[model samples]
Target: MDTASLKKEIIAYSKTIGIDKIGFASPSTFEEMKVRLYRQQELRYQSGFEEKDIEKRTEPSLIFDKPKSIISIALAYPSKMGPKVISKKGERRGIFSRASWGTDYHTVLRDRLKKLEEYIALKMPEARFKSMVDTGELVDRAVAERAGIGWSGKNCSIITPEFGSYVYLGEMITNIPFEPDHPMEDRCGSCNKCVDVCPTGALVQGGQLNAQKCIAFVTQTKGFLAEEFREKLGNRLYGCDTCQTVCPENKGKDFHFHTEMEPNPEIAKPLLKPLLSISNREFKEKFGHVSGSWRGKKPIQRNAIIALAHYRDETAIPELITVMKDDPRPVLRGTAAWALGKIGGQDALEALQHAFSVEKDEEVLQEIRKGLYFFAEKKQG
Candidate 1:
């Protein structure tokens, strides 16, 4: 295909395939990016992705054996639900993440990509194409930026002008040579709202994130919540959307991308009471397919207990007592004890003592005391 015609056909085909944005990138930029990536990883900024694989990620040969061009795609996750409503939907009334409030994007994006691939295959049967959606070792964010979609924001999320940082990215690496698009100019000149609003200070001052400090990462992590950070978590049952909410660039751009009329009010803003009483079967029935459900019912349940403590609502004491003993997971049991203590009062203190005897680990003992002190101070009252 001639350069002019190929670019036209690719752009036309990309829109037809349902991708919001499309761009081509020359293979050479991939090689240059590899070098820069190594330095970034050495500095400990890359999100816990295995840095040892950096060499393979930069190698164009690895991405496409005979690669000459890259086709980048963007899918927007615009939801009308405001930040406060979206975050609490699942556990409050019990719903899903705003992104998962509608159909799962994985299936939606893939179906569209399949159509793009079939068209390319028919156009040139000898040509080959491989598509990935947040799958594979390629530096996807870097590729998308180079492909001229958007620049990486201070929160480390790609920020598109039209959709802000709410767009999901995917790509198709191909052997077909297509004209490359110019990278977009960085527009986040001096904005730092995303950095300042981060609950755990994960977003650094200069557009990078320390993922370990990220509340989103910690919430999704399997296993125990560290003793030090437990109190800092607050009521976030799933991913923390604080950074995105604070971005000035995202203001007034309401684009809810679903046919659904409005967010399910039940999950949008719950009172942190019913979730503590949710049975495993009920938890599954409510949140199983949602994005936050992947960590299973345990983490969400554990978070609910923590939120009760953070909120300091004594009404949750009875429920907390039940979770402190009968909850199957020891970490949940331990957190429940800690939460109970934070709620204070005689009942909460007695439950902590009971939990302390059952808990063998010294770490849990420390948390138990932290909760117990609330009553110890109150006893002096």
Candidate 2:
């Protein structure tokens, strides 16, 4: 079997199955990445979501037996929503980042990888393969960079020449000796736009991120948002796209190649007040198909309350009061209390004062105090 011919066939087959870009890489130990992983660990900069084993993450051989090459694939998602849902006064909305605009990308990428695997298996019956999306042990960006998919951008995303940094990456490890593609040059050069625009200053430096400070990571946390980052969240409900949106490389880079990748404006940018009262079943029914819903409604709802605060929407005050007074989750209740304080008015202050007197939870009481402080500040001013 001619390995070179087989690689060419796989590339051609990939295009037919909706893979936007494909590249092959040698399955060598990612020595440089291993160093960075250790540094991230030492600095406590890692998001708890990543696979814990650094060896498995960097050494393909540790996860897949006799791996000869890694096939990196990228699928571009839309940067712009088709029919914009205007977030006007009295009807403010929260936004999921562009990455969560469509059907869960994990499902889309996994389907594409499975098809590629099936095609390769049929051609070479003995080829052993292992594949993974974002949740997998292998770092998708590192694999893509090595496979010539793109360069690792300043914002810690794979910036493909064709799709900028708005691409979803997946990889397959196999015992096939395909010729490796060369990695792309660091086109980011002196551009620090992504770092400059990161709301939380999550981009510690070029190609490095302190995930704890990233609004994208913070939005997914199922807890009371820290007071410092609350205002920075703006109306983002799930992830933060400030870094990508500010990237000059991503300028004019929007693609609608796959129907599944399209955003439903209503779901992607839904009314914030409606989100405050949404039932579990209602939340699941509407947002379950999107990747942003994976953390479930708790984080999204918490962020929604903060978004309401960001807009200082007087109309959402009633819903925020209800959440503050009756929500089962302490995080939501506390977040609602804070939102009430931020969206201060006579009614909002009255509700916070009432909650402070009756709320049993210690954390909730503290939030209620924080809420009342806004009124105190207003009086002093």
Candidate 3:
């Protein structure tokens, strides 16, 4: 059978195995992406989590031997939860972004890619294939754009007409010389909503991001969040979706095709107070399966403290004091001290004063001073 016929069969089989969209591209070097990546590096705008080797990221031939074509796949995820966990006065909940809604996309997309590989192997026994999800050296969005799966959105996401920007992307590099799909035309003309609504001005322009200022990146860091970004974080525990949510193309684009991708409201948006004292074992039992939990409980817990402060939830003051006093991690202790000041009252003031006297870490001491300053400002007001 010719490669064209096999490509058609693969596309058909993909839908059967829960793959929503698939496109093929020439496995040539991503010349344009290489330039942008170098510029991003020069500006120091890259998130540290990304693959550092730009050559491996842009050159498919470096990672895959004898690469002839690349196949890009996308699976749409739900934008809204089914049963919402409402955030009220005392029971305020912190949210994980829609990307971290259900089971990890890495696991789900890899499963689909594995099935596709096995099917292709049966058809062409000599076909060689290498597959990868988000963490792979090859940039998934660039490949998806090249393969006509979607146009790269202003928000730096691949925006498929069918699923908008709420899609998980994966790719497979193969030795089979398949006809590549036509690339999609840019549809984000004259739209700057994503940039305008970015909480931290992280969207430097249409397609570029300063990852250091991005709340999505900030929430993943295991340190005291910069004072300026804490309030911007709002109630987000894992990732920020402001850019995607504000994009006009993503409006009303919610798809729940895979059951495994469906979110449990309680887990995706859990009460913030319970998280303050959750043991490592309990956190794993509850959030272990989700992609947001990949960085462990520290970032989440720290963000939850910031969220409580954002709400000015006086009820959480007791919990924040406990975290400040007893939590071993200085980031959490320092953040909780700052939060206590943000949620000022007699209790919070006393706690901050006590922490100031007892806290040994200079960073924690600095936070206690910041907390005390809030009270002084309030008194002058």
Candidate 4:
């Protein structure tokens, strides 16, 4: 089999199926990445969502027997959304970060990878392969960097020249010995824009990230947001985009190549108040198709409550009261109490005091105390 010819054919086919960029890489151990990951682990900077085993994450041979190469693919998603949906006055909207703007990218990229896998299988029936997207053990950014898909940006994202940082990345491991492509150069030198703009200072120095402090990672947590980051979260419902939006490379790089990847403005930037009371069925039906909804409704609803406080939306005081007084989940009830305190008013104070009389959970009681403290400080000032 002419491996070169097969590689050429695969590249051609990938473009036809909506893959924005494709590259081949050797299945060598990611030594540098393993070291960096070890350091991150030592510092307790990991998001706890990644694979725990470092060997399986960095060593290709551990995953696939004598794996020869990895194929990396990038699919561009829309960054510049369509027309804004106007929310009525006294109503505020919460934003889902750009990565979650469209259909769940896991489905989109996995579909393309499956197609590629089939194409390869037809050429060599005995060839073994393994595929992965974000949830997989192998780091997609590391694979993309080695495969020439893009350069690893200061924001810790793969920044392709053509699509910028607004691209979804996925990869496949194979036993085929395809020629490897050259890695991209570090073009982010001297530009501290991404690091400078991180809302929570999560970007340490320039390249490394403290995921525990990152707004993007924090927004996905099921518990109450840390006190410091609650205000930093702004109106983000699922993720944070300050670092990416500030990246000069991502500027003017919006691409609406796939129709399915288009953002419905209403879902991407939904009204904040209504979200606090949305039923499980209603939330699923409206947001089930989007990528950000993968963590389910809890985190999104939690962040929505935090966002209402950020806006100090007086109109949302009643809804916050309902969540604080009646929501079954302690995280929701506690977070609502906190938000009520942040968006201080006579009604917010009254709700917190009432909940204090009947709230059962100890953790929730602590939050209620914090809420009332905000009221006390306000009155004294």
Candidate 5:
């Protein structure tokens, strides 16, 4: 069997199937990454969204037998919003991170992998294969770095020379012993732009990240946001793009090659007030197609309230009061209370006082008191 010739064939076929970039690497144990993972765990910096099993995450051989090589793939997504984006005066909008702007990359990449796997299976009938996108046990960035897809930028994103950091990564672990490609050099020397621009200082030193402090990680959490992060969140509904947006490598890099990845302006930069009142079914119908909707509407709605507060949107007060008083979830009610305080006025003050009297939940009551304290502090000033 001419394995090298087969590799050439696969690469050619990958281009036909809309894969932006492809690279091959040996599937050895990721020794260095294991150390970093353990350190992140020791510092209690993990987002709790990652796979808990460190051994399974770093060792590809455990996932698939005789895993000789890994084939990493990348798809470029558009970084900028579409032309028809609405920017109104009274009603402000919240931005979803660039990754979540398009149709879910997982679905798109999975389809591409299925095609690659099928093509390889026909060529080598006995070759076993396993593929994963961002959700898989193997760290996508680690695999990408080893596979010569891109260098790991200081922002913790894989910076492809052609696509910058605006690319979706996925990989295939195969039993084929294809020759490995050379990894890209770390080109982010002395550049602290991503680190300095990060809203929550999630970037620790150069490459390490405290996931707990990252606005991207914070946006996905299903509980109450810490007070410090609330103001830092700005108007983001899901994920944070400050690091990538600030990267010099990412400058003038916006690709609209894949049709599935085009952003719907309304969904990507949605009105803050309308999000607070969206029903469960309505949330799904509108935002279920986007990647940011994975945690469902609760976190997004909570963040929307915070975004409205960040904007000091007096127009959103009615919706905020409705959520504060009538919402079933204590997290929402509590967040709404905090936002009302931040966006304070006489009605906001009255609402906080009224809620303080009847709100039974300790957390919500605490938030109401905090809301009223805003006025007290204002009066003193």
Candidate 6:
């Protein structure tokens, strides 16, 4: 088995599989990353992650055994794709963040990487290797930078010259002695577009990010949002792409290329009315393939209400009033009340008053009364 010949074939195979970039690095390149993970854990940034993530990420053996090289792969995520017509009365711009505009990358990349592994094994039957995506222990973005896949931007996302920061990263750890690639130079010089445009103030100075305050992370988080952060959520139902959209690297890029990944017309830009009234089974059938569907229908439905409230879309008020009374999830009921307040109309106010009278939970009833007060006050003024 000629190891050199196999290495060359692997790279060629990866490109053929649709990966935009591939590079190599020594496993030792991630020493600093292990330390930073500990610091982030102490600071409570990774509270949701199990302790195993912290432990395994630091294990040199876990990523590779007697490893001599690392391979990092990048897949270009189409950042723009949506409808052409805009309604003058209600334009809910149902744009997909570059990452979501295609079939989910997890399956696509995994299938490719697994094939690459099989190729390597055939060439060197005794070789050792493992592959992983975003779900892995080792910080994918950090390894990506070391492998020269791209530079870590101020937004803390991996950015390539061709794909900007709108790309997904995956990796393979192997014991083969392949030559590592050079890293990309930092091109984000004097650029603060991503930070300046953030609605949640999650990005700090020097390119550090606090995920707790990130709108993307918050939207995906389970349970209800705090009162203070509710209104700031705006009309974002799933993930927030505000920071990435404003990036200079992503700006002016052509969108006419490939954008077939946009959601179904009705599903892509969901109607507030239907979202507020759907059964759990219907929600699953519609959004099951998308990232937003993972946390189940409750959080998204809750976010839809929040977004409706922020947009002040009074047209959705009738449905909002309906959900306010019958939503199985208390969180959804609470958020619907808030939306009714924001979209105050005579019918919405009356619904809130009725809810307040029947509401048993103090916290939920408080939210209902809050909505009623605002609706009544708006009518008076």
Best by lDDT: 3
How many clashes in candidate 6? 2
Alpha carbon lDDT of each predicted model: 0.72, 0.93, 0.95, 0.92, 0.91, 0.73
Residue lDDT tens for model 1, 255-347 = 665343234445544557678777779877766545567667777777777777777777778888887777666777778788887778788
Candidate 4 lDDT over residue span 16-47, tens digit each: 89999999999999999999999999999999
Worst 10 residues of 4 by lDDT: 82-91
Tens-digit lDDT track of model 3 for 1-381: 899999999999999999999999999999999999999999999998999999999999999888999999999999988987789999999999999999999999999999999999999999999999979899899999999999998899999999999999999999999999999999999999999999999999999999989999999999888888997999999999999999889889999899999999999999999999999999999999999999999999999999999999999999999999999999999999999999999999999998898889999999999999999999999
Q: Indicate the worst ten consecutive residues by lDDT in candidate 2.
A: 223-232
| RMSD, every candidate, angstroms | 3.4, 0.8, 0.6, 1.2, 1.0, 2.5
Put down candidate 2 lDDT per residue, 65-143, tens digits, no spaces.
8999999999999998888779899999889998898799999999999999999999999999999999999999999
Worst 10 residues of 5 by lDDT: 81-90
**Residue ranges of candidate 2 with Cα displaced over 4 Å:** none
lDDT of 6 by residue, 13-61 (tens): 8777666788887677466667777776677666364345665675646
TM-score-best of 3 and 5: 3
Better of 3 and 6 by lDDT: 3
Candidate 5, after superposition: displacement of residue 71 in Å? 0.5
Q: Kindly give the stretch of ten consecutive residues in candidate 3 with the minimal lDDT sum.
A: 223-232
TM-score for all predictions? 0.86, 0.99, 0.99, 0.97, 0.98, 0.91
As a whole number from 0 to 100, the lDDT of residue 300 in candidate 4 is 93
Task: Give the TM-score (vs. native) of candidate 1.
Answer: 0.86
* Per-candidate clashes, comma-separated: 6, 0, 0, 0, 0, 2
